[model samples]
Target: MAGGNFMHRVLSYVINEVVVNGLANSPAFQRFAVRTSKTLEDISVKASKKRQELAEQIKEASRNFDSFKN
Candidate 1:
């Protein structure tokens, strides 16, 4: 039982080391990060634009409502 536990820990450590090294050395991962970051930035900009449009629409609607009430 103790041997099994020791083997499990060793395998886990080796796997984690390999994965860390692989990621660190991978250009593909770096490119992926850059692409994902750019995509997120684009989405954020679009969202801000949409929010502004909605705000303007709401203001217009409010003005219309006020005039109706008057």
Candidate 2:
């Protein structure tokens, strides 16, 4: 029924406004967001370092193969 649909929309809007806006207004949530961002950045940097190391290892291996052909 139309009444049920109206109530559903109203309830959904209230929940979105309260939960989303409330968390954004909270200091604890802000701290959590900062920590999560830092952790992700650290992981990204570590991964990039590992990738570069692997690339260097591959280059060294390819050189070994080239030297063997002579």
Candidate 3:
């Protein structure tokens, strides 16, 4: 049973390596990775801008509230 388990592990490792290498060398995968990264970067930029805008609005609202209290 030990030997059988060892063989299974070895086979699994080899198969995983083959799949990883194949995907790494694939052009389609490379393009997909680049596109995904670019999309994520764009989304990050947009979210940052929105967060800043929200912060500015909050500050403005706070100033307005303080003026009314005085």
Off by over 4 Å in 3: none
Clashing pairs in 2: none
Better of 1 and 3 by TM-score: 3
- Candidate lDDT scores, in order, read 0.98, 0.99, 0.99
Model 1, global lDDT: 0.98
Candidate 3 clashes: the total is 0
- Clash pairs, candidate 1, are none
Which window of ten consecutive residues has the lowest lDDT sum in model 2?
61-70
Please write out the lDDT profile of model 2 over residues 1-70, one tens digit for every residue: 9999999999999999999999999999999999999999999999999999999999999999999998
Ten consecutive residues with minimal summed lDDT in candidate 3?
Answer: 23-32
The TM-score of candidate 3 is 0.85
Tell me the spans in candidate 1 whose CA falls farther than 4 Å from its real position.
1-10
lDDT by residue for model 1 over 1-70, one digit each (tens)?
9999999999999999999999888999989989999999999999999999999999999999999999
What is the per-residue lDDT of model 3 for residues 1-70, given as tens digits with 9 covering 90 to 100? 9999999999999999999999999999999999999999999999999999999999999999999999
